[model samples]
Target chain A: MSPWAWVLAAYGCAALLVGGYVWRLWCRYRHVSRVRLGEADG
Target chain B: MRPFAVGATAALLSVGLFLALWVSPPDSYQGEYVRILYVHVPAALAAYGAAAVACGASALYLWRRDLRWDFVGRAGAELAALFSGLTLLTGMLWGKPVWGVWWAWDARLVTTAVLFLLYVGCLLVRDLADDPERGRRLSAAVAVLAFLDVPVVHYSVVWFRTLHQGPSISLQGVKLAPEFLLPLAVNTLAYLALLGVLLAERARLASLEVER
Candidate 1:
């Protein structure tokens, strides 16, 4: 593999994984917040 | 995570990446394969730090029987797994070009892989138990035990003959050149910052799950 290929692969994967985890957290928090909001209204 | 922390993490990571890829010259020995070390080393550091947090938090949970500590413990274990996974992946990326193999049976590599799996098991133990309280207690113990592999992983190169290189930066002083060390130091702080942000956010999310 080229140097850029190796570097890009490593950095790209790191960025994507971290971004994905953060997105998952955001989704979960929103989900729970919605449930709490519904419960509050009910 | 708080806005300031989130911003700081992004800034540090951006600057660190630039320094790693652009500013730091290629290694005379390893050439461009050296760039992988920039990310690989920091990920390992962050992984070990997360495991330590998990161990400490787990012990706290055991002592105080506090759900808050459990939240941190769970977050720590999860981050440990994530970073360890990255460490292994990036290590392989570096290794294929340098070591000529995607995987090795070396002690450092094997122990690190074990550390990753053990923390993963720590996470699972909590959900698998019949009682929540029992699960917490059991997982707390598991987390503490899983942390034992961390030191073994760290010293594995010194303790056993391995493909992995010896410690570059340690109490004995850094072996990395100034150019390499600067970005590595920056990336280390960046990863630590990222670790803090993720840990707090994950713990907060865990709290919300219980709260709702």
Candidate 2:
């Protein structure tokens, strides 16, 4: 592969990995917040 | 995880990416591939910052014996591990085209690998310990000790003959061209902002777990 290919792949992988992590964190935050809210409502 | 902070980070990163890929000129020698530096360098710096935060929080935990400090230390360690993994991944990708090899036993690479593993071990120690308090104390100590590898990773290129290049931008002056420097600076700020968002969310999740 060309150098540009490598560069693009590297940046692409970094974006996916970091983005996935942030998404996971966001999901967990939402879940926990919902749980807490439910308990409050109860 | 405030909506405003997340939205701002996304917008900042979008602008940074646009500048890095489109506006910045290619390196005279390295050409377009040099764009990888925008991601690689920021990931490395963010990893180092996260590790430093972990080290400081670990020390605080040990000193005050507070669970809150332990929570903060854990969050920092997790982010450190994540960014370090990204650093190594991007480094290997960058290395393959430039150095003609994907992996090397050079001082900088080896030290960074060790640093990544050390934090992973810290996380394992926290997870596998039998008691919550015992786990926090043990992992706090591990976090502190693991941080000893950080300076080694940073100075490995200087202290030894290595395949890695020396620092490009430092206290002396900017080494990169103006076009490259601007995007690099913006991307670094964007990465730091992302780190802040991640750390805050992680800590909040951890606190919720403890309360439950």
Candidate 3:
């Protein structure tokens, strides 16, 4: 594989993994907020 | 609430990324691989900055028995750990090609790896402590001691290194051409500002959690 291809692939994979993690983190934050709000109302 | 702080951080990051990636000239030696400098070096510096904050906060907590300082210590410690992990990952990726191996037992690499592990251990300690107060104090003590390595990690190359370049743009004073310096400086500033904001947010969350 070309050097550019290797670099792109490595970065792309890392971005995907880190992006998924950030999404999960955001999801968890949302879930916590919703749960907290529900508790406040109940 | 702090619009100015948020705006400054965003702007810094934007400019930093732009300059580091596009403006900086390719390294005479490394070519495009030099681009890794924008991320790896900044992350490393940010990690050390966070760790230093953790150390200072840890000391304050120990001396005053203040929970607030402990909170700062914990929050910064978490961030430092995250950045340290990123630095190591990027370093390895950059290393494999340059050094011909992904892993090395050189002094700089070894010390940095140890530092990262120490922070990870700290995270576990905080989680394992049953009482918040007790946990914070204990973790603070640990953080203060562990941070001694911060200087060693920073100077590892100068002091003793198995493999790793010496200080580049930071101390060399305009060692990087405009293309690289602009983005690198911007990114470094952005990462630092981001670190501060994240620590503040984490501290706020911890305060609220405790109140609850």
Comparing 1 and 2 on lDDT, the stronger one: 1
What is the lDDT for A19 in model 3? 53
lDDT of 3 by residue, B1-212 (tens): 66777688778866765665566666766666666767777887888888899999899989998777777898878877877777777777766765567776555555567778888888888889998677787788779878996566656654554245553322233266665666777788888887787677666666655555
Give model 1's docking category: medium
lDDT of each: 0.86, 0.83, 0.71
Candidates 2 and 3, the one with greater lDDT = 2
Give model 3's docking category: acceptable
Off by over 4 Å in 2: B152-175
Highest-TM-score candidate = 1
> Residues B1-212, candidate 2, lDDT per residue (tens digit)?
39999899899899989998899888775677778888988888889888888999999999999878887899899989999999899888876776667876555566667779999999999889999888899988999998986676657654554345654322124257787889999999999998888887788888997776
Best by the lDDT measure: 1
Clashes per candidate, residues 3 or more apart or on different chains: 0, 0, 7
TM-score of each: 0.90, 0.88, 0.80
In candidate 1, position B132 carries an lDDT of: 85
In model 1, pairs of residues that clash are none
Candidate 2, residue A26: Cα displacement in angstroms equals 2.1
